[model samples]
Target: MDSRSLPNSSKSSKSSRAEVSVKRSPVEPRVSTLLDVISISMGETG
Candidate 1:
């Protein structure tokens, strides 16, 4: 059960990251960097 759930969680995280990348593409570089940091922190905690 743990092995199965690990891949599923990673998959969902990838999808969410992709969506965020697309939405932030046109935004400022500084904002994008900030978002990247936030996402990384969230990933580590979660």
Candidate 2:
């Protein structure tokens, strides 16, 4: 589902806030993607 489907969003400020708004997850970010996990581990190892 798109973030626009959620509350508090209006089309007017979307161009500026879209990135920040879409990043707000109601749940914790998952480690579902292998690439994501790998990058995280690599960062930790640095």
Candidate 3:
């Protein structure tokens, strides 16, 4: 993992306050990739 891994992971799973409208952004592609990695990490740990 690198420096970005932390912030991006946190941002994606942080809260539902802005979650709805947040998906309309163009950055969703990259963010989704990061979320995938986070999901794998969570699965492995659990």
Candidate 4:
């Protein structure tokens, strides 16, 4: 029981970590693009 539970907990933790990373990546690109565009516009104006 202990052995099985240990592996299961590890798998769940890894999956949760992967899911969080996947969720974060989509938002990062959008925020990054917005910052890039704003910088470019400021550069042109300045």
lDDT of 3 by residue, 1-46 (tens): 6998998888877765477557657688889999999999999999
Rank order (by TM-score, best first):
4, 1, 3, 2
Report the number of the highest-lDDT candidate: 4
- Misplaced by over 4 Å in model 3 are 1-26
Q: Runs in model 2 with CA error above 4 Å? A: 1-32
**1-46 in candidate 4: lDDT tens per residue?**
6888999999999999999999999999999999999999999999
**Candidate 3 — worst ten consecutive residues by lDDT sum?**
15-24
Best by TM-score: 4
lDDT (C-alpha, whole model) for all candidates = 0.93, 0.66, 0.82, 0.97
Is candidate 1 or 2 superior in lDDT? 1
Scored by Cα lDDT, where does model 2 land?
0.66
> Clash pairs of candidate 2?
none
The true-versus-predicted C-alpha distance at residue 43 of model 2, in Å, is 0.2
Better of 2 and 3 by TM-score: 3
Q: Which lDDT tens digits does candidate 2 get at residues 1-46? A: 6886554456645755866666765333553466788989999998
All candidates: CA RMSD (Å): 13.7, 11.0, 16.3, 2.6
| Candidate 1 C-alpha error for residue 23, in Å | 0.4
